[model samples]
Target: MARITYIEHNGTEHVVDVRPGLTVMEGARDNNIPGIDADCGGACACSTCHVYVDPAWVDRLPKKQAVEEDMLDFAYQPDPKRSRLTCQIKVTDAIDGLVVHIPEKQI
Candidate 1:
């Protein structure tokens, strides 16, 4: 299991043990973390699962696809450096301890 910390916009944090092969969105949904609605269910079609990867971890994630890059355009909380759809990030040993912060709103 990998330990991931999900912090809400208000600063509350939910740390969860995630299966290594699961998507970050899956981990959040399975753990009942409040902010990541993941409405499109990892299909990369919705921005509901938006999250900000801690600066230090950004370079460690797999490169985003063109579709994911385009979807960021629809994310209200979009930040070029940190914003990412949680569904696109996979939980793996390479990033064993990842910390993601959630925005206040998701639509």
Candidate 2:
């Protein structure tokens, strides 16, 4: 399991352990972390689960796929270099200390 940190736009932080094989979106949903609406339920069909990866982890995480990249365009105030769809990021030991910042709102 990976211990992921979800930081809200207001600075509130939620740290949770996410099992391997689950997406980061699932981790937040399971732990009741606010800000990740997951409107598409991990299907990568919406940008409600958008987040900005912590700079330190930007290169550590897997590269974003084309679909995720396309969907990010609809996210609220997306940052080209940091924005990602939580639904597209799977949990793993390599990402044990991953940190993601939730945006002020979803689009």
Model 1 lDDT tens row, 1-107:
98999999999999989998999999999999999999898999989999999998999899889999999888876999899999999889887789999988997
Off by over 4 Å in 1: none
Would you list the C-alpha lDDT of every candidate in the order shown? 0.92, 0.96
lDDT tens digits, residue span 10-90, model 2 = 999999999999999999999999999998899999999999999999999999999999999899999999999999999
Best by TM-score: 2
Q: In model 1, which residue pairs have backbone atoms overlapping below 3 Å?
A: none
Give the top-scoring candidate (lDDT).
2
Residue 92 accuracy (lDDT) in model 1: 91
TM-score for candidate 1 = 0.96
lDDT at 12 for candidate 2?
Answer: 97
